[model samples]
Target: MTAVRVLLADDEHLIRGALAALLALEDDLVVVAEAASGAEALAMARAHRPDVAVLDLQMPGGPDGVKVATSLRDELPSCRTMIVTSHGRPGHLKRALSAGVRGFVPKTVSAQRLAEIIRAVHAGNRYVDPELAADAISAGDSPLTAREAEVLEFAADGAPIAEIAERASLSQGTVRNYLSAAAAKLGAENRHTAVRLARERGWV
Candidate 1:
């Protein structure tokens, strides 16, 4: 049998190393590339063109796993993407599915289970952890608009309105409006509380 080529992307060196080592034991799976950041993950994906990419959900220094999956959906449709996240927030699961990720699972899964998921995804089947799917179903849809969500993400780090405006390329007044709207929708007294609430609900 031809081994399935896999790309492993995670920022944590020890976890990535351990995962790569564990996956190496599988006879029908071979890790072709490894990356420590989302940017490097994209670069490696382009360079190696693996059959499946198992990405960490929150890699730094570039796009997150969902963003990378979306990009791959456009640039390399042949490659299947899956996310393994410790967070496993309902919103994140929903976003991953929307981004064309073939599988979504918690980091608590065994390596053997993860290998099975990879094979399943490679066969054009989708998998989502049952608990996560149920939680997403109950969480309901995010109330924040696309622009509101974007602006709130900018405000996540407590950046001032001017900085957020510059980053989002909107006027400071517009930024304040979005923040106010988002806070109101979330029933938060301020943008800071809104950010916390949205994060807890995985809406931001």
Candidate 2:
């Protein structure tokens, strides 16, 4: 059997080393490349063209893992992609799915399970950590669209409406409307309640 060529991308060297050690145990899996940032990950993927690419969601320098996954999905169909992230935000998972990754798993998972997930994805199976899937399902669909959530997240951070509008390139009126709508959807009494609720639900 041909070993699965794997490309691993993460900002943390320890994490990369640990995962590499674990994956190396399986005779059918081989770590072909290692990268410290999303841009480096992409460059390596293009160069090595691994059979599977594992990416970190929030790399410091360059487009995020989801963006890279989208590019790989479009340009390299035979190379499966997975997102391994520390953040368990439901919105993040939803967005990752939209970007066309084959799997999404939290970093808390056992290394053995990660290897299994990679194999599953290589077999053309979709996998999402059960915990994350449950959170996503119970959290329900995102009540706010991306723009609405963006505005509210800014407002929640105490940014003035005008500043929020300017940053989002939206009119003040539109920003206000989005805030009001988000609050109403969250059953929040006001902007503060909306922010707290969104945070608690991992929707932000």
Candidate 3:
């Protein structure tokens, strides 16, 4: 049987090393390359043309993992991709699916399970962590309005209401109104809570 060539990409050194070790144990899997950033991952993928590429959603460089996956899908059609990240945000899942990634695995999942997911994706099957899938479905059910989402995204950075208002090109009163509406829609007690909930639900 032919071995599966794999390229692993993640920002953290320890996590990358541990994942490489875990995947190395798989008799049919070969770690062809490792990347510490999105740019490096893309370069390595292009160079090695691995059977599977494991990417982290958040990484340094202009294009993220989703963008890298999209490129790989277009440029190396035979290479499959799996997104591994600590963030299980619904937006991230949506983006990964849209980018044509074959699998989505949360960082919290066991390394053995991650290897299974990689193999599954390489075999042309789709995989989504059960917990993330549930969160995505729930987020779809309770969608946020476009304006509300914008406000919450700005708020997440600890931006003051006035600053948010100015950046969003709205009056202070308008900003407050948007925040109140978003809070109510999210069943949150305050704007901060609303922002947190929105992010968790992938509204922002």
Candidate 4:
């Protein structure tokens, strides 16, 4: 049987090394390339055209793993993508699914599970970490509008309402409305708490 070609992309050296070692033990898998950053990952993907690409969500580049996955899906449709990261943020999952990644595995998952997920994605199946899948479903219950998300992001950075309004090009009242809407959606009592929660969930 032919071995499955795989590419690995992650920023941390030790984590990448550990993953490489774990994947090497799989009889049907071959690690064809390794990348330390999103840019390097993109270049390596273009060069190697591996059967599967395991990506770290946060990396150095203009766009993160989701964008890389989307690009690969568009330019190299045969190459599958799986996102592996420590962050199991709902927004990350939402964005990754939209980008066409076939699998999502958090760093906390065991190496055995990670390998299984990679192979599953390569074999044309979808995989989502059980913990994250539950969170993602719950996260979908409360939706934040794009405007509200923008205001919250600005507010999280210590921007005042006036500054946020100016930055978002909305009236002060409109900014307050957005913040209020976000607070209500998040079940928070105030804008500060809303911002904190949004930040924690990676909405901003």
Candidate 5:
């Protein structure tokens, strides 16, 4: 039997190693490559031409899993992508679906279930964790504009208005306006409060 060739990428060593081991035990699955970050994932995908790419949602020193998945849609159309994350946020799922990923799974799932989902995704079907899917449906549209969210996201990282402006290529006054608007929309008392509220709602 021809095994399903797979590539796995996650910056967390232990989680990545453990899942790789579990998948290796499957008779019909072959872990053809492994990576520590999204950049490494892309390089290995090009080299191996894996049938499926399993990636962590967040990684260090490179594109996040969503960006990697989006790239793979164009760079390796034959390879399907799956995002596995610890975050239970529904906004991430919405973004992943928009990026052409074939799967959205949580790290909390059992290894056997994850392998099953991978097989389904490789067979040209989409799969999402049931709870996350429901959450996505129930969550209303984000109250913050994309620009406002961008500014508030930096605030969540404790960045000053000047730094946020530099990173986003917006003027300091514009960034401040976005921050203020976001705070008012979220009924927050301050930038920190706005960021916390947005994060709790999974808007960031």
Candidate 6:
């Protein structure tokens, strides 16, 4: 029987290494590539053309897992995709599903369970953590527009309006407008509350 080729992408070194090691023990699985960033994951996936790509949800310095999965769906439709996140949010799960991810599980899942999930994904089945799916059902959709969410993410660090404008490449007035609109939509009294609410819902 042919082994399933897998690509593992995660920014955390220890976790990535441990996962790689554990997955190597599976008789029907082989780790074909490992990457520490989303960009690298894409590159590795292109080069290796693995049967499955298991990605971390919050890799730094590039697109997140959902974005990578979306790209892979376009560029490599045969390659199945899955996400493993330490921080699973309702909105994120929804985004992953929309991006055509076949599996979404928390990082706390055991290696044995993850291996089984990988097999399931390769067989074209979908799996989402039950708790996360329940939360996503309850959280509903985000009301904020793309621009509003982008501006709010810029404001997450409590930066000044001028700085946010510079970062977002918009005028201060525009930044304020987006923030205000976002706050109003979320029923937040202020932008800070808006940011907090959006973050808790994983909209930003």
Best by TM-score: 4
Q: Write the per-residue lDDT of candidate 2 for residues 104-199, one digit (tens) a residue.
A: 999999989999999999888999999999988888887788877888878877778899899888999998899999999999988888998897
* lDDT of each residue in 85-195, candidate 3, tens digit only: 887888789888988998998889887888888888988999998899988887774457788788788888888998999889999998899899999998999999998
* Residues 95-138, model 6: lDDT tens digits: 89999999999988899999999999999999998988898889
Q: lDDT per model, in order? A: 0.95, 0.90, 0.88, 0.88, 0.92, 0.95
lDDT by residue (1-204, candidate 1, tens digit) is: 799999999999999999999999998999999999888999999999999999999988789999999998998999999999998789999889989999999999999999999999998999999999998998889999999999999999999999999999999999999999999999999999999989978897
Residue 99 CA displacement from its true place in model 2, Å: 1.5
- Which order, best to worst by lDDT? 6, 1, 5, 2, 4, 3
Provide the TM-score for each candidate, comma-separated: 0.87, 0.89, 0.86, 0.91, 0.89, 0.90
Runs in model 3 deviating more than 4 A are: 60-63
Q: Show the lowest summed lDDT stretch of 10 residues, model 4.
A: 134-143
Error of 6 at 112 (Å): 1.1
Query: lDDT by residue for model 5 over 1-204, one digit each (tens)?
Result: 699999999999898889899999999999999999999999999999999999999898879999999999999999999999998688888889899998999989999999999999989999999999988788766889989998888878888888999999999999989999999998998899999878866789
Error of 2 at 46 (Å): 0.3
lDDT of 4 by residue, 1-204 (tens): 898999999988998988899989998888999999888888999999999999999987566888889999998999999998887998788889989999998899888888888889988999988889888787664479888888888888778889999988889999999999999998899999998888667677
The total number of steric clashes, by the backbone 3 Å criterion, in model 4 comes to 0
Report the error of model 6 at residue 203, Å: 1.1
Q: How many residue pairs clash in each candidate?
A: 0, 0, 0, 0, 0, 0
TM-score of 6: 0.90
Q: What is the lDDT of residue 169 in candidate 3?
A: 92
Superposed model 2: Cα runs more than 4 Å off:
145-147, 169-171, 199-204
